[model samples]
Target: MAASLLYPFVLLAGALQALGNSMNAQLRVALTNPWLAALVSFLLIVFVFVAMAAVRPQPFPEKASVAAMPWWAPLGGIAGAVAVFMGLLFVDEIGAGPFNGLLITANLLASLAIDHFGWLGMKPKRLGPMRAGGAALMVAGIVLIARS
Candidate 1:
């Protein structure tokens, strides 16, 4: 599918992500322990995925396919959890706008590097002038957001 066609879904996801951070921050405060809050939040996710898998069972991955996976492949969840944990710990302190701004700005910067280098099996896209300009604009926007 063309990326433009997919853009709305991504936009919705971004909006939901910001909401989730705020909700998670509230969860942390209510629980009074970041670790417990994160666990409760992620445990629900685990249950939902497990239920989905059970309902629509697929063949287990072939041993060869499993063996071919990189060691870092399973770490994606860990990385995401770290981000969530940070949000849970700090979102209320920093306020949603600035926190989300910094988070998204960092994400964009890292995404640019990842795309430029074609890391994690992505197709290599050169850091051309337009991409660079877009990144600069994102940084500028984040600065304005953070200051506001």
Candidate 2:
């Protein structure tokens, strides 16, 4: 029952992502600049976060709390920027299905490696036959989607 209820939210997330991608892709096409499109996308995120912070008024993290985090934690923005840039650059030309498929493939492989090796302080999850099979199936599905 819980899984079924949660599934719609997952679907909704994908739907929302698709809409965002399409909007950004159009913006990039109009601007003729992926970098500008990405900038606008990120600026919107900043706006929303700023509004959210105002509405909720959460306390700022203490100096010690920031100091305790790994140095690499601060570099996550680069990854987010790359995602926005790539989506702006390619989503319209390549289409969402193939882009998502390739993204998912890369994400799954990276996640599996991260989990298996406990990289960046994640809990270690040893890979097994089922995990291997699932990853393989995902790759196969992506291949089929790309071929289509």
Candidate 3:
């Protein structure tokens, strides 16, 4: 029960996401296109990973131990990166707070659906009336913020 008190982790995650979005918005302003922005961002992330690895090298699996994953695996990363950069640009045209509020609302709804259906092998959660009502309120808030 005490472990469950880590619920604040959700708030921390949201804060980190908001911070990441702000950085992405800044990068979007510097780049000409979303694709270019994503590319640069990806390169920077890879560079950071390499630098960390240099400081603390981790064991790598043998080539034989690696199995080919579905092509969709890599495509998913590419798609996510492209979508984030594009979303940043779209939201920047409006406003960061509004865009983030709507985006967070969308994420909440999507997570609810995923939890309800247990998509991708996730454990399904019962979506009671309370959860549904809360989701509805979130959507309403997003709409109000967007319209403001």
* Candidate 2 to truth, TM: 0.89
Q: What's the lDDT for all of these models? A: 0.94, 0.86, 0.78
- Per-model C-alpha RMSD: 1.1, 2.3, 3.2
Which candidate number maximizes lDDT?
Answer: 1
Point out where model 3 deviates above 4 Å: 1-6, 54-76
lDDT of 1: 0.94
Model 3, residue 92: distance off in Å is 1.2
Q: Candidates 2 and 3: which is better by TM-score?
A: 2
Q: What residue runs in model 1 are displaced by over 4 Å at the alpha carbon?
A: none
Per-residue lDDT of candidate 3, residues 1-148 (tens digit)? 6977887997897787677777777787788676677678789989999999999998987776456544455566675675477565776687777878877887789889989999755799989999999999998898888898
Ranking of predictions according to lDDT = 1, 2, 3
Count clashing pairs, candidate 1.
Answer: 0
Worst 10 residues of 2 by lDDT: 80-89
Clash pairs, candidate 1, are none
- The TM-score, computed over Cα atoms with residue i paired to residue i, of candidate 1 is 0.95
